[model samples]
Target: MFQNLAPAAVDPILSVAEAFRADPRPHKLDLGVGVYRDANGNTPVMTAVRYAEQQLAQTQTSKSYVGLGGNMRFSRVVTQLILGNAEPTGWFTMQTPGASGGLRLLADLIAASRPNATVWISDPSYVNHAPIMRAAGLRVASYPYLDVASGGLRREAFFEAVAGLGQDDVLLLHGCCHNPSGVDLEIDDWQQLASMVSQQGFLPFVDLAYQGFGDGLEQDAAGLRLLADASEEMLVVYSCSKHFGLYRERTGAALVKSAGSKQVQGKLFELARRSYTMPPDHGAEVVAMIIESAELTALWHSELYAMRQRVQSTRHQLADALSTNGMEAEYLCHHKGMFSMLPLSEASIARLRDDAAIYIVAGGRINLAGLAPNKIDTLAEAIVRLAA
Candidate 1:
């Protein structure tokens, strides 16, 4: 039975991380993985998270299952965080292992509801979006997004693609801090997309992984809320990994907004029951505690704000360093999140890895959060020397 089994395809992102670990260079730089690091190159737990864990340790009593929907309190808090003042009558939320699991669960629901439906993603979307959707037996297609030449949105081409979407299409979008590219849609752009989505009748599916890492918690969620306000039915997959520092906890949610929310919720619960059964409750409980308490929520917000500012500062530092080296990289400052794609070819990316000990993911994505400020000049020099 094992003889005919084929080798699994290597994950593009994880393989880069593995290669980074194997490299023997003492001065190697890893900007491949999309995790936030401080000035000392550490992914420290936030004060709020640590405090929440302590409180959970003292107050929590049992390890009983949290049922298929996981923590309803967590779901409610996350919904409020995402939708803000939107009416909650037609909304449903369920916990998942993480955004990845949430993505798969929702994909399964889409497949079950409409097997022929096509899920449209950004041309250069999150690496796993298409694979997960397709794994659930859904057709995946791409719409225009980033304009490589300008390091900005392909506005005209994007809208042109959106114009063709109809009832059978599910448009997947990055809520904020677009992965790999870091280019984000402005509020005006979201407004236009909402109008187009309302008129075109395609279901809007949003993946919000880096909510507070972009501008602020409220600012990052603005576009999603705008889209939510206009649409009667929508799908959202949210992650607490980035903002709540719950990466290992796999804390996330799948949210549905429809007139028949009860039916959709039942479908999601059934899908989830067949899979992981129930999401781990530890992280969700911790998040619920943090969000429920006003004091802890304030602390979390402050920490999130600091992380956002640090990433932004790193972007500016890199841009300034590149500018001083006579490279035009002002576009870096305009990018919203932890990632920004440098225009390097395959050969250049390999050269960066081989000659300079700099590990960047394929497609030139560098995690500004992973880069330390003191090493900015070295990175800028390498890019200028090797890119030319």
Candidate 2:
């Protein structure tokens, strides 16, 4: 049995992390993974989360489970955060291991309900998206997204891809702060997508991982809300890892919206029962407490706002430095979120790693939030050398 096991390929992002950690260089920088880091390169727990945890530690009575659907309070709170004021007719929400788990769970549901459905992902999407969908036995398709050569989105190609979607297809979209490629849609583009969904009869699967990390929380959900209004059926995967700094806590939710008669909530509950039975309670309860308290909620908002501003500032600084160094990287300034794709080839990325001790995904996707502002010039110089 051991002899029959095949070797697995190392995940590109995790491989970058491993290489970055092993490097002995004094100034090595890692731009892999979308974990948010402060200006000092520290991933700090938000004050709100800390307060909630303290409260739970002091007054918690039991370590009992939260049941198949996890904490309903947490589910409602997360749902409200994603949907905002707009209330869809029939919607279902469930606590998941994480956004990754939520995505897989929804994929499983899609496989169960519509075995013939295809999941259309962005060409240069989060590396895990396609794999997760395919693992569920769903056919995967690609839509043109980032044009690395010119450092911009191929809007016409993207529109054509969306326009060609079939009724049994699900278009997977990055709600905000698109992973890998930080390129996000404008209001007009989202509106166009909503119209396409309405006309094409396809479902939208919105992945909302970095909500507050992108634009404002409310602004980030704009596209998802628009799609909810336009499309009768949708799937949303929400993650708390970045916004709440709860990476290891494994917290998130899977949301589904369908017709009133579909009993989607019951189906989601059954699915949760068969899968994990129940999600971990600590993180979800912590989030619920924070959301329930006005003061804690405000504090959470403040910290999230500061984090977003820091990432934005870093992006501007990086773009300016790259531009001054004669590199075409203005897209960094325009894109929102924790990650952005650099206009670098595989050879250029390798050169940066081998020669400059810099690490980024092979496709040049980098975590803009991971940069220390003071070191932006150094990173910019390395990129300029390799890209030039």
Best candidate (score: lDDT): 1
lDDT of 2 by residue, 260-313 (tens): 435766677777788788889889999999999999999999999899999999
Candidate 1 stretches greater than 4 Å from native: 85-87
Taken over the whole model, the C-alpha lDDT of each candidate is 0.93, 0.88
lDDT score, candidate 1: 0.93
**lDDT per residue as tens, model 1, 261-351:** 8899889888988999999999999999999999999999899999999999999999999999999899999999889999999899999
* Superposed Cα RMSD, model 1: 0.9
TM-score for every candidate vs. truth? 0.98, 0.96
Model 2 whole-model lDDT (C-alpha atoms):
0.88
Q: What's the alpha carbon RMSD for model 2?
A: 1.4
